[model samples]
Target: MSTLLLRLAAPMQSWGISSKFNRRTTNMEPTRSGVIGMLAAAMGMSREDSLDVFNPLRFGVRIDQPGTMNRDFQVVYQNPDDILPTWLTYRYYLEDAVFLAGLEGPSGFLAELEAALMHPVYPLALGRRSCPPAEPLVLGIRDVDLLTALRQEEWQASSWYQRKAKWQNITSLEIVRDASPDESGYAVRDVPESFSQKRRLYRFRNVIREQVFLDQLVSSENTENEQGTPKEHDPMELLEDDDVSIKSQNQ
Candidate 1:
């Protein structure tokens, strides 16, 4: 199988799974349905078109930069009359996040997708229409499986983030991939049945989570480990530390 890698970095993204009326939520990572929708748009496939063709492709995403979540408020007026009340809604988004996504399938099919992504028929969005992705979305195609490509790929986080984190010292990254039902994994309702806006449909998929070591790109730079390498940059390492702080604040 061949893998098509995508650099999914955006200023704002929202991958909602169970969002309803006034409140929309977001997942920490990109969702399968969202990725499929973007692919469909790239190929100029309408909502009524069959997504089954792409369903068999193995999908996976590596979190290169886990961004912070923030919420926004909106107010909508129902009627022109001054007496009418306003509707309040809250939307959540991931700010400045970056993900390395992989799609493994037949070499020919992946080649077509890689081309389409470069010259997409329709505009692409991260998750919502308002959220446009940064340039260079098409990373490249690899002659390897989804998991291997995801594991071996270099970090795709923003340059600023990498410099702030001193990525040279990082050894590996974490990845989550679609797993078969027979395998032990987390269940997520992101599989798309039909993307028709009028009648959206979805199913479930099993996800296997694991960590992959960074390649020589990182190790080579850190080989010296000399005093010149500044130890102050630690944004990536601060992820865990910030998480703990948030949880503690909640408690």
Candidate 2:
């Protein structure tokens, strides 16, 4: 087995689980379904395609930088003349966050995915089409289990955020991962059963959550590398962008 590491840092990201019409909300961190959707897109899998290929993969994530939350407003008008605030809703997302995602699977399939990510068949997004990810998305393959791989990976938080954490003397980071058959964990409805837009589906998944001490993680210079490093000039990269733009959509 092998683990594929992903540096899911984006200026803006939204991973919604129970989001529906009117108001869409984001989860605190990356969701498995959201991540899998991106992967499926990378492989050019259409909405009607089977998502069975992704079912066997075990997942885990380490929150290096838990970012601030931001909201978006969307308005709708039945017609040009009918515009008295007919519809208004709020959408929430995470700003300037960094996550180290690990997917454990067979080496061959993992390798295939690694290459596909490098040259994705379809454009990738961080939860939503408006939120694209930054460079160095694929952190390469790790020859370890899901939990160990995430634990051994280097810190992915921005430099300034790291400094702030150090000053505050923060020692641990939140770690969440898919639970094994014998492992106990809380249940979340994130496991992807289907990606068909016509009738989107998801199943319950148990995930183990724990705190990993800062010392237990590897430190790095945050350089851009295959092993998941940030760009040299990354501050929040928030001021700049991965070419991210926001436009109000008519719901």
In model 2, pairs of residues that clash are: none
Backbone clash total for model 2 is 0
lDDT of 1 by residue, 1-251 (tens): 89999988878999999999799999999999999999999999999998889877999999988899999989988877767578889999999888999999999999999888888899999989999887558877989999878877767776577776665676567798998567889889999999997999999888999887655233423422532333223446647646656778889
Which stretches in model 1 have alpha-carbon errors above 4 Å?
Answer: 80-84, 167-171, 215-251
Candidate 2 local accuracy as lDDT?
0.88
Model 2 spans with C-alpha error above 4 angstroms: 79-85, 222-251
The backbone clash count of each candidate, in order, is 0, 0
Question: How far does residue 7 in candidate 1 sit from its true spot (Å)?
Answer: 0.2
lDDT of 2 by residue, 111-214 (tens): 99999999999999999999988877887898999989888888888878989999999999999899999999899999888887698889999999988888
